[model samples]
Target: MQGFHVLVAGVEPTARQSVPQAFRVSEVVALDAAGLHLLREGDGEPRATGLAPLPCLALFATPKTLPLMREARAWIAAQAAAPVPDVVLLDRKSPPAFVERTLLENLAAANAALAGSALRQARRVARLRAEVEMLGAVRAGLDRFVGETGLAQLKRVFSTATPDFETQIELVHGAPLRQVLPVAGTGFAAIDLACTGGKRRGSFVARLTLLEDGEVLAEWRVPTPAQDGWVRLGLPVAHAGLLRTLCLVVEPASEKSPCANLALGAHQPLPAAQLGDARTGLPIAPHSLAFRLYAAVPGTTPPHSADTLMPVAARKAKPVPYALQALPAEDLARVAETDPGTGGPNLLFVADVAAILCRPGAGGRIRAACPAGARGLMASVGVHADTPSAAVGVLGVDAGAAEPALQRVPVSSGGVEEVSLLFPEPLREARDILLSAEAVDGAAEGAWVVFRDLRIYT
Candidate 1:
């Protein structure tokens, strides 16, 4: 979502200096990637090394400079890549309330199985089932929360950029602006929320491999070939912002994946943020609650309990909790509240503020309409490189950064109280992570949270 360029007509860069730098969540802006002064490669005589329209176009997280560029050395073929830029700013910061469920508590059941020695393996299987059920419950619950909670509206801001982050920061630091197509990360938070607190500038990147004779050519860290291969995109923290969640719209390449390595690296590093507080001088908030959730296995098949998936133990799910520890209270409340209706504080645009933007007597610089449930906003776009389907471009960038302002968010999420999941977005996804809670001192097993008038002003 960061380092974006606004295209006026998909073919030229605009002359306007004060353009929409970034956009709010789901706010579809346009791109103007035409007339971009393409940097030439070589000496005076217009060195024509028989360049073939780049043969392909792909995008990278980093411009393949410095440590990343160096690590990508050896022409060992495309492995993968973040650049140095304005840190992502975590606008809505919130801490997490780790909770557990029945299936997870059954973690103890694995103990008896383990003690039986002969039943150790048996217990392992049972534990795994418990864990599986734990996560399934969490996913279902989270889905429900998002649908029922009003906070889902806040999602419009999720994975979006502010006008400032774009022009003032990104325009000078990362890429150009356009009015055609735009892109962003998936959600917020990371696996290590408990420690560093997820916050980072988002970037669009992919892994690549060069081949000479089907033998891997000049492995350049670029985008999916406008030709072949299964490409994977990644986002790293160029700057700092409390990352709450990250979810790729992942409009897959026209074709499907080929089981194994069709192209990109393991999808593990895609658009993910850094762990621990390396930049910020603060420690991850000591969350009063923390939990882990995982994707459920198909066929209702279960997994081994404390036997192995112990990672959910933090030592295992350690990374996840650390990530959660970095969010804010409002966001945390949204996640912890049992009431799905509590997802968002009934969001309302400050009328006075809205009126100014929509002033019939003023310029059309800003629109007062909040585009939701539509095709999303699609304004001016600058596509340095565009794809017919998804956002994929092969970029060969220069060194140095544009130092854009940041609004970082974590790249991790945890499970609801009882349910479990492989939550990755730090705080943003809290409201969506599935969790199971204990019966309130003899209360019912169901739990929920609620929100009030969420009014936005100037």
Candidate 2:
């Protein structure tokens, strides 16, 4: 009567496994409990044959009726001496208006009481432990208190719990930790040359702060060898939170000495940024380089080609031509626009059109290499039209395979949506693959699809 139990009925499909077969609406006309056995009678009073074990029940309006809901609540009230149910599963989909309101109100009240009891119990245990430690002995008063409040039962139940209460419930409500990504490091070339003859390596500190409140989330330091000319300080910023705005404080090896000319990169496209400050002008303002945040999930296996990634400034210096034919260059480019610079500049997609066919004369295919061990590709895509039935997918091809693996993406006529495509098991070990899009429903050519920030992560 002091522990947690859930009430479930047959009508709730998801709670079916938790409910006993005897208590299902179809199996029982009346449900009564005798010790651990739930007496389920079919259209009659409980009989000896109807006795069955039921450890839990989850009550819900399964048949969409008000009477059943009331009956379930009444049964729970009648079992007040028994343990109060801790979890209530309510059907949110299409319930009687009054039943929905009543269920939510009662469920809220019960859960609030449960939470309060748990908190008080925790405080009581802590106080008893403190008293035991101070007195250096277990007191009779403590024993009596524990017996009266069922503290022993709580302890026994919690001893075997995996995560414990605080981690599972309390800490989950706390602020989330956002991951910080390493974008670029100030190589500090000339500063390294000047500090080389002194003593130690020259270092630079980069700070990330909130623009609104100026709260420092994290700071990173990159060290460069003083004698190295083309020093590339690959400093990784390992912090978490919603990050924005960066500040760099240059440090020389010696005190009271001016730092030499500092450079930011030894790599191209070294974390795009703007140098000027928008706020009040200051000395730090002259030195501060503001950059946008780029967050990427860490992956163990690198993609075969990250050559075509997001925020691409222009077509690759050596453009890999699409294995395309049939459609004229202008129409083909217009139909499936690959150059991101022409439109909204970060994503890759087929241009929006009133209608476009996917026949031999219209559709084209683009091939991209997928190295072995590649598992999946993730991308944000949107397909929209005046009507429905828009879709896209990535095709994976194996070296000796007769057929290529295809992952088709269906798109609604709404705004943009995120999509993911998983490669087949055989194709995961494949060396080459093709990514293509075509009209799924041949009759409808009005569909338009766009894909943005496509990445293949292992």
Candidate 3:
């Protein structure tokens, strides 16, 4: 009863109301085909009795109907605006061989169209049902507070009372359950620059990889376009448990694209792999890389219990000695190693042409000033040659002073030794310092000296 109702077009209008209920006949139209019919719905519009050429061609078959075929072909070629019948129902008690053949040939198309239409209708019904359910829930919630039976009270409250976070949280939790911490800082340079600049539209492909324990949790290669200076991507979040580390590598789709620098958190100016000119038949590597490490916190939510007792504990902050910098071979000039394969500290010399760079504090480029209460400078040094002796110098820049100061210490070394340059007095304002090792008694040119563990402590 809820489905399509058959409208017999060939039947006379006088017999429309007389049709049996089993036919589900909604309408009847006059036509010349005495034994033919069309199964369709009457949608309150003028219905056509004559069939369109497409349906006509689909209905009749065989050389015996060649004249009728010609007439249908002419009608189709004319392209006249006309109503198309949904189905062709032969009225003959037993269809002729040709008619049966014609129905077999066109049966698949009819079934496919019917299925498609039904699917569309089903989707619309489902959407309407969801909307009605949501509205019911809203009405129930409103009724709880206003003790109202209709939507008028809900509309009045919305029109007069402004909604706020506190009110919303109270409705959700009966009380606020979380605290808000406000933080402010200038964001990433790339994001800030892109926002300030006018948008230029284009799209590129990028890939993301999430890995842990040598297993790939998730990966995606997607195309993104610049819109309003930002390209947004929705990544899968369900695999958060599998992700201990995430790395994103952005590669150019082809060889022609130019490259840009990548910044990771607070670590900017990170050197990236260089991919030379793409046209030169050289393989290019992805230069933009970002990595993050995640750690899972162990805990569980407890059932709400107002009877639980609060525990007391005490904590304090203190400064502990930390390694300022490790002067590795890569950070020094004219560096050589006695046993490079052994993976030990390499030999660095004072005669080196360039002064080795060191951070007396955390991070690069931010120079650490000697603390007013700095106890001494600590270093690890040794001689590899016979007699095992060397002279090391300390270079420092004093606060509020332009000139640099130097102190020398001679080491009669046999094995690796921990040496300290204790300040004659607390260097109240020493800013920065450098250490250089050289042969003391002219033992050899470019004397081999092992250096490591350079630190300053208060």
Superposition-based RMSD of candidate 1 using all C-alpha atoms, in angstroms: 37.6
lDDT scores in order: 0.21, 0.35, 0.33
TM-score of 1: 0.19
lDDT of 3 by residue, 289-383 (tens): 12221111111111111221111121111222322322222234333332333433332344242223221111111134345566666556554
Looking at model 3, report the run of 10 residues with the lowest lDDT sum: 150-159
Q: Give per-model TM-scores.
A: 0.19, 0.30, 0.26
Report the number of the highest-TM-score candidate. Answer: 2
Taking the candidates one at a time, how many backbone clashes does each contain? 176, 10, 0
* Superposed model 3: Cα runs more than 4 Å off: 1-245, 248-287, 290-375, 384-407, 423-430, 437-439
Residues 102-193 of candidate 2: C-alpha lDDT, one tens digit per residue? 44555476677769989999999999989878754333333333323222110000011121112110001111111122332121101111
Model 3 clash pairs are none
Model 1 per-residue lDDT tens digits across residues 1-458: 23332211111122111232341111111112221122221333322222112111111112222233222221112321212111111111211111112212222443443367657778899999999999878855543343233222221122221112111111112221111011122231111101111122122221111111122111112222333312222112111222222221111122332111111111122222211121231222221101121222221111112212111112222111111111122232332222334434221212221211011111111121211111111111111112111111110111124321111111111211111122122222111211111111322212221111221100
TM-score: model 3 vs. ground truth: 0.26
Which of 1 and 3 is ahead in lDDT?
Answer: 3
Model 1: CA > 4 A from native: 1-118, 155-348, 351-458
